[model samples]
Target: MSASTHWLATASIQSVLERGGNAFDAAVAGAFVLHVVEPHLNGPGGDMTGIFATADRPGEPVVLMGQGPAPAAATTEHYRAEGLELVPGAGALASAVPGAVDAWLLLLRDHGTWPLADVLAYAVGYARQGHQILPRVRDTIATVAELFTDHWPSSAAHWMPDGEVPGDDALLRNEPYAAVLDQLVGAAEGTAGGPDPTGTAAGRRTAGIEAARDLWARLVGREAEAFLARPHRHSSGTDHAGVLSAADVEGFRACYEPSATVSFRGHTIAKTGPWGQGPALLLTLAILEGFDDEYLDPSTELGAHTILEAQKLAIADRESYFGDTDVPLGHLLSTEYSAERRRLITESASHEFRPGTVPGHPPFIPPLRVDYTPPAAATGAKTGFAGIGEPTVQPDGETRGDTCHLDVVDRWGNMVSATPSGGWLQSSPLVPALGFCLGTRLQMTWLEDGAPSTLTPGKRPRTTLTPTLVLKDGQAVSALGSPGGDQQDQWQLLYLLRTIVGGYSPQQAIDAPALHTTSIPGSFWPRTWTPGGAVVEDRLGQEVIAGLEARGHVVTRAGDWALGRLSAVVRDPATGQLAAAANPRGVQGYAAGR
Candidate 1:
């Protein structure tokens, strides 16, 4: 299938527009389509993060932080108080107010060229009609189904789309779901439907043409469901976080605003933005400036060695020092890049150390902690570096996690990058319906009883879902992103350095094998894979690995044929040619351009 077949790529977005959807509409449409195509990663049950720059807002870009924050009923004390070690389960506590709807409404309000009902028409249709399950989808279902094993119907339902998870190419359909979408997205625009898609702003009213406007406006509505209901089959409702009196759709924070931005090497970025990590990128860039780029890109031994060292040092500092800049982790130092941080990084890289994971562990986690936490700092800077890191989710279990990354650029010199993710349930499985797969992202936190990232009411867990963009003269040159958990930034940095800076074409950079270094201590979750250099199908061969190993690299094998699928788009300055490439590791990770 063509990459444009999905919506995030501008080719596909433009296709939707040709079929009568605007950028906002196309994004929403693409997301819905993606749910049909790659339900294992995201769906109506999950959330969305979108960055759409309208020609109208040429100067100020629009960013929608669509990902959900912790639910109101969740409390840090609740998890710690339960004596539950590690992450929580996927019960009522794991979910957040469905942010996709709110973000969708916000985007519809601003840049939507068509009616929300119209944009959702395709998604709802696909949900009901069903899409075929590709190898990737089946792989995800087969691997991840076990994590949801305890959740009953959800586990059984999600995997058995076409009689016991079809092998390879299986025809899949969500008829029951399609009916539901028809009802939800088909709600009247105004007077007739129960929902008041209004009050947020005048624009969201979606005031369709006079005749059908009132009808469509009031078409559909959402009533909160029980926190731990059977399982959601569609975008239903969430009863008040704790228990009874149901909360209405209106209670969700539906307003959209610009994201907090940081600049790195002259490029603007957003932390917790269209995807998380605007500051981290800036911090990494700052650290890189202190070194020689050409020297850093030497032998598989010297090159990967330098990056590994730098990756460990910078990532370690982020774990301790990073937090919501507004919330201020007074105990931790500032995440801003500084000469002190650079100096500390240089000093710390000369030695080796493994940061400890949460609870210190029985196997003792070996400091191979996950990297999705807020910005952090290594303890007192005692030289933290290791040859290992996985950034795994329920590792050694053969479990699979779902995630999506897509970048879009309009002909108008505007670009957008967004990554959407949710882990297994909080710590357990709790599916309310069949239509949506609830995210257990809360489990990503350390859950150390009183720790901040733990089960805090209405708080968003930290994530390493970073999106990378390059802008020159305030115009976008390229937008790049991946879905490899913590390794995302690591692989992305390499890609950016070689492709954007070293001047490799988009396709060439994408074809290049990727590497990762988990050499830093995770703030919360356990780190799984080690970092060094990864060869695609032995593409660059053993010589590279041997050289890397000699440099103290673990050189783990990513044998999955397709590993860490990366998608990127590049804009050539002189030619104005728009080129895109999908990493070879992923069958579906192909890029299309017009």
Candidate 2:
């Protein structure tokens, strides 16, 4: 079973399975297709985090640490010298070392049955031929059309062919990107021996894929170095040059890390280490575990209030300490710590950013909001990042935010959940030669000194991209994730509550209404906070909304089907059965299984 944000990606997974590939192969194929079909959400130059359980080692989950670190020259002083208080959301200056491709390749090489060429074939076809443009893609390009035309001419040429935004029905093509993928295929083909072929299972555990991985790193490093050398207009409304070097790219590599986890109910939830926002979800679950059954029910007035408050407290902790550096995760996830943090939640909403107090370490509180009001000169230009423009849905209706998520579970009991994001189309200027953009993930850092997420060379920004793996009784059971910027885990938490506590099926849990608190400081560029703010789907009804508002929550209804694009796949090893479900909000999501 497999589920993804787009039908094409889901179908790609099924195609892989039909071709006798395993879950890892399907995941690799689907991930590449997501790059083609959901360009607005992710790109070749992006980053990703995944948690997977291989059939050989069922309960042992591994974290795919594809969250690339900042370029060696990306220092706080350099950005400050460029006359910027906060990192620019979309620009060459905000870019990080690209890592998603290498990470996916690593997974494929280590676990997948198919060769590199087979996995990339789907993306190559879609990019060379044409895929129907998503409305959101058209909208994103249109929003940044002026910026592209007036400043980033390379982007204008790529996204806007005739110097105009493409319509939703337009068949969007990226021949350049297809060419890049083809080159990667060629690299793999060059090493493929008579004993192995691209699509055949004979190539399992062969050197051909390793050769392709080596060539890919060298090629991307060379191109990224060349692109960063050229100056581009930044979100600062000024032309700023990048400091990345070929060495920065070549030195970057993705690896497996031990997953951080916390046991709740009868399950153990695995997350990326403190470097990403996964720990926040675990902490929220810990705090909520202390609540009564009634308050834990998310559909009720009291239950909703409790969940929101607990989320706010846990997210505040994320802002304070979670980062790339060595974190005191043991202390943070301790039972004593959970008890201490649970005391912070109250009946009324707490607008304060209160990170927990460790005995030896002092807490670092980031600026409530890094004043990101656009400069007077750039007023005419669209400010606040591309995908994060004014909320897509107003009280009436609007659409906003973008990311790609995939979950796969095979007949062999292997499962994986990966959330790929960062190098979105609107994140940076087009690297014409590569037919993709660099990720502006460096913007998730604080420039201030002594903070865990402070900008430092070779350190990863505290990324919001997080994937989830759930294990019960020391056996792998499910893999789940979503894509909603800071709301990623917040939405996942709701799904967990519904599925684990409310006893809803994966589809029923995902189809239910979702909400997330914006009261904590955001981790995106132009980081800001909203006091007592919460956005909920109207499907929760007026009574729930009224109850939340009466409890001091600043409630905003985002219409029914306006939030969350989560997908999940589950495996019942005992019965050899697999099931899956996808979000129904946008009609783009799909799920498939035998």
Best by lDDT: 2
Task: Give the per-residue lDDT digits (tens) of candidate 2, residues 1-594.
Answer: 999999999999999998899999999999999999998888988889999999989889999989888888899999888778877776877777888988998898888888788889999999999899988889879877877888778889999998899976899889989998888777777767545656564453456676667776787778877876777777666668887677777787789999999998889999999999999999999998887778877778888889999998888888888999878888888888999988877778877778888777778888886345756255575443345421223353333346799999988888999998867788777888889888878878888898899988999988888899999988889899998878899889998998888899999999988888889887765677788888899898899889899889998888888878899998887887889999998788999988
For candidate 1, the lDDT comes to 0.49
- True-vs-predicted CA distance for residue 202, candidate 1, Å: 9.3
lDDT score at residue 342, model 1, on the 0-100 scale:
51
Stretches of candidate 2 exceeding 4 Å from the true structure: 194-205, 375-385, 388-401
Q: Write the residue-wise lDDT of candidate 1 on 276-376 in tens digits.
A: 44445555555565666663552244565566666665555455434322323221123343444455443122334422122222212233432323121
- Positional deviation of residue 347's Cα in model 2 after best superposition, in angstroms: 1.2
User: TM-score for every candidate vs. truth?
Assistant: 0.77, 0.95
Q: Candidate 1: minimum summed lDDT over ten consecutive residues — where?
A: 381-390
Instruction: Give the TM-score comparing model 1 with the true structure, all chains together.
Output: 0.77
- In model 2, state the lDDT of residue 198: 60
